[model samples]
Target chain A: MTSPAPLVVGFVAATVLALTAACLLGSTPMGVERVLAALIGSGDAGDRLVVWEIRFPRALAAFLAGSALGASGAALQGLLRNPLAEPGVLGVSATASLAATFFLYYGFVSVAAWGLPVAAIAGALAATALIAFAAVHTRSIITLILIGIGIASFAGAAMSLLMNLAPHPYALSDMINWMLGSVANRSLDDIALAAPFLLCGLVVLYGTRRGLAALTLGEEAAAGVGLNLPRQRLATVLGAGLSTGASVALAGAIGFVGIVAPHIVRPLVAHDPARSLVPSALLAGLLLVLADIGVRLIQSEQELRLGVVAALVGAPVFVWIAVRRQAARD
Target chain B: MTELIATGLTLRVGRATLVDGVSFCLRPGELVALLGPNGAGKSSLLRASLGLQKRSGGTATLGGRDSERLNPVTRARLVSYLPQIRSIAWPNVVRDVVALGRFSHGAAIGTLREADRAAVERALDACDLLHLANRRCDTLSGGELARLHCARAFAAEAPLLLADEPVGGLDPFHQFRVMDITRAFVGRGGGALVVLHDVALAARYAHRLLWMKDGRIVAHGTPDQTLTAERLAAIYGVRACVDGLRVALEGAA
Candidate 1:
């Protein structure tokens, strides 16, 4: 039995290393000396502007978004008692993206800086409520996943409709770029806007960890051990909704970091769902920072969307996991 | 003194009465077996008594307090429950599963207190599961999983245990082992209400027998008084012979 403490420490260290790389390795690359000098307020104006203004906020946003998704995914998986469960699969991210896109397409985002996240959170909560209602009627994991897919498809279609109805080509292209999902070009203001909702969601999810752990024995047994099922359910749904919504609001619809990070961390934590949250969040932050760095490294006419890279990397892994699970069952 | 008392307990689901005004008392140092045919409301009675199900009428008290009104922690400390449908959603190890019994005992959020560890150890030993403590629960056989759940309930150390067929899928050796564990729990001044389909095993191990048909208790007394051939025929629709503490089903009446 390996202790989770070292694994968590290792993940945090890896995230720090990735964050440093994300900050230094962008289009105008900075040496380690200049990066360190910029942090200490002694570098040239260009270096400081490039490091602090351009890269620092984007790196932080990517890290925060990834942490939110990872923690939310781990919590959702525990609540649903299904390893395949994730914010993206559950339609939370897609619905959130739809709401944010709606705001952006309608030019409402220009009215209030917080409008996008607020709308996204509302959409996320609505989708989560729908899923929670469906969950009560079905005990089959596959059925729940199918319901999630249906919801995701509906939201995706609505987003496309909004894209088609955009009044101008600029707005249409803006919506398209935002829907593609990226941490690039995000400002500190974006991070500030989404941080509160993400923090609140994380707190709620953390509070439900004990209940989620108890649920591994099934609902009746969990309640028998004094867990308040209704309260736990509410907390889990609300938490996952808020965090996932805020992540999408900050970085569009980055998918699979939530699902992938937890899978990577679960074994390190001895498969204890409750113990998996913090490590998952750290690993998720690392994954997103690395992916964002990958976006900058690949030289193309236009940089690849962070979401596109994540899916390309994550979809194959997801298939491999599903196949492996099927083989194990056989 | 009574560890559990239920009077006129009733459960209804959409106009269907599953348990109708069932009442019983479980005293310390007593092993009571609830016996009945399929759909006789034995499971519902246990669930309702533990406040796991809504009772349309009547009330249940644990240690002289209304069970329904008690806080979850206090209720869990007073009465432990073992449901018939056994499931493990995650691949948790056996010791971790057993330690969940201490959820209300200050084992919060994956960290177990000293007392929690001690209780889990005692329970694992009692159920003869110490050697398999580190094994993943999903890998265990049905019988071993059943014992693991039994061990979990035992770990709670609640005064009253409400078990719905705790020995349902075990082999003969394990069946007797589970009965002995229940007997030992009662021997230590704990009370138990067990639902069983095995009349002979119930007759041998239980201090008292409660026979039900439909949704009510039809007979309640010593095994000798409750396991009569006429009662068996009436309740189970079968003819059975009761010799000493053993019961054998002859045929359907």
Candidate 2:
């Protein structure tokens, strides 16, 4: 019942502002005019190199990854019918991280031109396939979620095992940095690598709107209303897997944006699962852009990770929403 | 012609027979009440009929096509279902929740054409939910939520309805109102299969009664034929006094 148009416009404006800040407030600060001029390839050579080579790619990567996570989160929450459900709930991010860590642990990063992201994406798709297979055999959505949790835990342990036996300290640090997650030094090539997966995932999630809306009435009722539960389940798993997989592949494992973004926008859409998808993506994109900016502005010897910053802000918002929902029930 | 026909329907869950070889026909302009004790497969029968639960052996046909083989949307257009559980995952508005009934018709909530809008409004008016159309489902009382689901089924305008325990939690007035709504739906040349535990109410409104026990229909006929004292004792483990359309449970059998 709530119109998402105004909220969507607001999110777009906020995102554009955040992006501008990201471009202009880096190591060597520049005016708005200088940044715009650089954007158009007419600024000073040094400024153009800084904007196009580094800041622009990183900013775009953050926004794209955030948008993917946000949309995936909304779709997963709708499909699973759980407010806490997110892209990570299905083990896509964890498995992708595990695969990337495996590659980093083995020094396979230099073996191929695009080794890490491809491995991560493959890992994500594998996890999604497993979930989809389980979805077919099981009748309960809760069972599917438990299976996802199982897969994630297994991937987490595997990553720990790999980290525990790192050949050298440098390998260990590389693995840790990936786990901590950041958009620093991301290249346009990286953006291009993850873009197709993200786009495909978002489109797949969009098609699941009707099925997810039917699920709001509960699984049995959803089936009663004529939704093909298995097909919907498969589509949701695939979509979330692709997007979440791509996010991990792009920026290492950024947490909480998926859950927090959709949670923030649910009230604005009057709790309609289908209506929350786009706004959730926009808000999440904005949040990540701002978090990346924070990462840059902080005066620390070691740059802070985007994952760490997001968890710091996101964990509390998750708790607040949970408590408020419980109170309302009471 | 029959709206629904079930033949030798059987359901098994790991060797336990839930719904045994049961068969029945629900014809248009008829209100058939499925009466049984708990765990007698009342809910399972309804679910199995709609292909929500897989049947071990049997067939359920809706509008002359196998229910299981029919596309979900096509099956839904033929039959609408009101499930027993009423909890909504989200606090969606009343109007939007009801509009979900139009899903099979290729209509989504928050976007409806004039004809779909008319059906939604009529359903809301019928269930006395028009006043609460703007209210959130999570804020509604148990009775109001029951009416909301009923309105959703009505809005579908499906020729056959499978309703499970539709009046379980309502007060007397709302209870009768629900029965009246079902009766009105039947009056409009639609068929309905309702699950009800209130024997008196079932007897009062249902033209036919299905007596199920241990996953089988033991007796089925007009209200007068199925509501006998002996049948009540056998089916419900109760000694009942039956007078015309009234059935009083005196004590344990």
Candidate 3:
């Protein structure tokens, strides 16, 4: 019998194909031909505006954000050396969420629209900086996660305080919408705001690809091989946080993409932590795109937020992964 | 021949000094074993040499250069290191893990320079891991995992190889295999500085011995000079007597 590599390759290739298909068909129910016609630039004005102005931009945001989260998750899992670590668990997501929340409550950008997520992205960087301080000093995954949890708790309290003192319905509604997360009615501006930081984060992470591999030999071995631990730690935190922050700002707190992307891509790459970064990014983009599409496919008249669907899929999948891991250990 | 000199090196961790006033030098192609029990400063001293730990006093020089002057990439090109036990967070394949050794030498992550691929292949072939190259590292047995680590370190192509317990948990056959490979590495214009626990293995493989007790070197010389019965009894609190074909360590072995 042949090895399992070919089977995994087939599965990944199929997933990519399906993700592309979903992206094409994702803006449907507005009209299939309208999406097709819009692509060809000959659609009716109403359908054209609907496709171009709304769904297309939102889809791109979800795709890019999910990809960033996926790549970041894989890298953090490798750098921290823990299977359970994610943007959300490590407080990277919470830090970003609080940043977004503050933006919502205080209107940090003082704009009519699109500034909330921008401020939220900045918040992600701030939180990442604090967490990196703890992670970089010593190469302990447990300490980093613990520090992230502390940051998350602190951010959570701050979030509660903001919610309590919200001045009006708009603030409360915006905060609630953000906390729950949605990609609804997002503009190209949202996409533009989050993209550069995510790309930069990706570049930073790519540079550490070798250093991260050296790390697999343990921090000491990594140092023996001439890896700069402080620099690697900085790259991991900032890269992961920037991508995560931008995504969270635009999409609101989408859970499990980080965990799921790396979890899937690692096995696909036969568990090579270094190469796992790129595949994780690809798979995360695909997973989020598919999930976003799933939301539209099951669209209800009452409008089910994408976060609810991700939770429905993401939470149980995460729990199953945990159970399987525990069973394997046993 | 390249020279590694550590003079009056003092490494302190927190409030505790791990290695105090330790001075040693290693020449090219020599197989020197650092002997000490667990919690001794063997690992700490090696780390200080590699700049992984801060030395409280003294300095280390490699090839007549201030060793710390070598940047991360340059340092990696000079000295290859292997730790005792490492945590594997991802399920990276053995081949890829071995290839990671070439990272510092590569132009970028995706582009493996011609020399990088050659080194990776050489490493895999040297460690007899060619068949298992495609296997996931996490799926390998303990002995197999250790062998893969050897391949990774060898792939680094450094002049000096520092290994902390490189074959600690392996079975006898694998231990022999690992030591033989290590010796082979040294024979190929390189030096090996190994930290070993088994006195017999140290006796069998090492060309020189640096016997450490507590935080200081009790003795440093050829095995015949340093592995005296009196010194063994003093450092290990176990008498060593070799009669004809039989060897004893006061039941310590």
Candidate 4:
């Protein structure tokens, strides 16, 4: 197998290219020279304003959200000892979506500017805690996944019910748009609001990486090797929850980047969960940024939703992974 | 040298008593084989001794410290355990997997110090897995994985080893090799308490045999005293002829 240095460098290169593309290709297309000049602070005021204020923050939001999802997914998969375990598929993101939507629809955001994001983060934490609690009681991976699916379905239904009773058509559209997910109209303030939580989550995960590595030996053996199992589980849950919550707040519950990016990078790190964390975060961030670029390039009457495009690309990959996992088991 | 002492250890699951009052001492430089039929609580006893299970009664001590009160890392440094189920969650390389034994010593993945690296290498060499050091654990056969976990325990350099069904999936050669590894460990003044169903192998390698029935110790002594014809019939319900440490089964009792 190849060393991690080249792989990390490759991911960085791809990300730079994608970020450049994200800047250059948009509703108002800018030339390479103009984008370059704008980037270096020598272009027209209008170009500079668009580049620095609008496009950059949106792109950054996409990347940060993707990084959060990717890292959270890797930590979760390591904790559960299942590659298929991810924030979106495990119902955490959906529940966060529901909480954010509830706050928005009920005018909770009017009372406090931080209410929606906090509610989303709390929702994610609650859902993750529920899943972790269930995980302890059951030994079968399939059962745990089914419980996640159940939570997702329930959250989806509740969100639909909220939409059904929405007081106005504009409110309905807003809810629908949020549910589909997009980084459009996102500003630096949104990134600023979510970044601290994301950083905290990543720090926690990084500190607990060794415990995740030990968990590969199975829970009991991990405990036997002197790992405090409860502490490990709590750290993983807190880390994954904070990151997932922040991502949902920033980007509205995009799915599958977590699963796909980690799955792709696992072999590069010799399948060690600890080593896979950073690379997975980088790759997933790149993938989401590229997907956002795709969303911009394809001209639709209304701009395409980033999450819809992501699901279109990622759901099939999810199926492929599940099938391969089953085949491996058989 | 450290010793493990258990007194009146009892484990009950709700209405059912899984492990009745059982007591024994595993001293350094001794290889003790715990023998029992199916569902006789051999696994439970091993877990209880390590404080991995919640015992309903009595106490277990390691080096004069209460087993339940010992810090996890301190307990791990005193004793290493190889469980019955050997499942590796990821496809980590054999060397990386074995190095996990140094977890109590603060060795992180991909960051092994000199002593940790030496211990891992020595364990691999001891288990004859040095040649397969880079292979992914998931690709290993059952016996190989079993031996790999044993090597992990050996890498810990703990004073006492508690292994459940360590030799079960192994072929004759590997089985004897595992027994020899335990014997060598004991010879080095370490202690071992192994759970096994192979009476003959236990009689051959162990300094003492603990015969348990229905979660209680029926007898514990040298092989010569424990492997009698009448005891064999009573414990295993098998009619057999006993000559010294050898038992030749004739039919079912």
Off by over 4 Å in 1: none
By summed lDDT, the worst window of 10 consecutive residues in model 3 chain B runs over: B244-253
* DockQ of every predicted complex: 0.63, 0.70, 0.51, 0.69
Off by over 4 Å in 2: A89-91, A109-115, A125-153
Q: List the candidates' TM-scores in order.
A: 0.97, 0.95, 0.90, 0.96
The list of candidate 3 runs beyond 4 A from truth reads: A1-31, A111-118, A136-147, A299-301, B107-113, B242-247, B251-253
Worst 10 residues of 4 chain A by lDDT: A1-10
Top of the candidates by TM-score:
1
Candidate 4 docking band: medium
- Interface RMSD after interface superposition, model 3: 3.9
lDDT, residue B77, candidate 3: 81
Residue A37 of model 1, lDDT score: 89
Residue A181 alpha-carbon offset, candidate 3, angstroms: 1.1
> Candidates ranked by lDDT, best first?
4, 2, 1, 3
For candidate 1 chain A, the 10 contiguous residues with the lowest summed lDDT are: A171-180
Candidate 1 on B1-253: residue-level lDDT in tens?
A: 6478999998898988989888899988899999999999998888788787778999998889887777778888888888887787777889988988888786853567788889999999988899999998878987788789989998988888889899887888888988998899999888998999899899999989999988998889998776788888999899888777777888999
Write model 2 residue lDDT over B103-211, tens digit each, in one string: 8887777678888999999999988898999998988887888889999888988888889999997898889989998999999888999999999999999999999
Candidate 1 per-residue lDDT, tens place, A1-330, comes to 545788888888888888877778877767999998886789799998888888888988989899999999899899888877888888888999998888887779789988889999998888888888788789887899899999999998998899778898988877766677888888888898999999999999988888888888788888888887789899999999999899899998888888899999887776788899888888888898889888888999987999899888887877787788789779
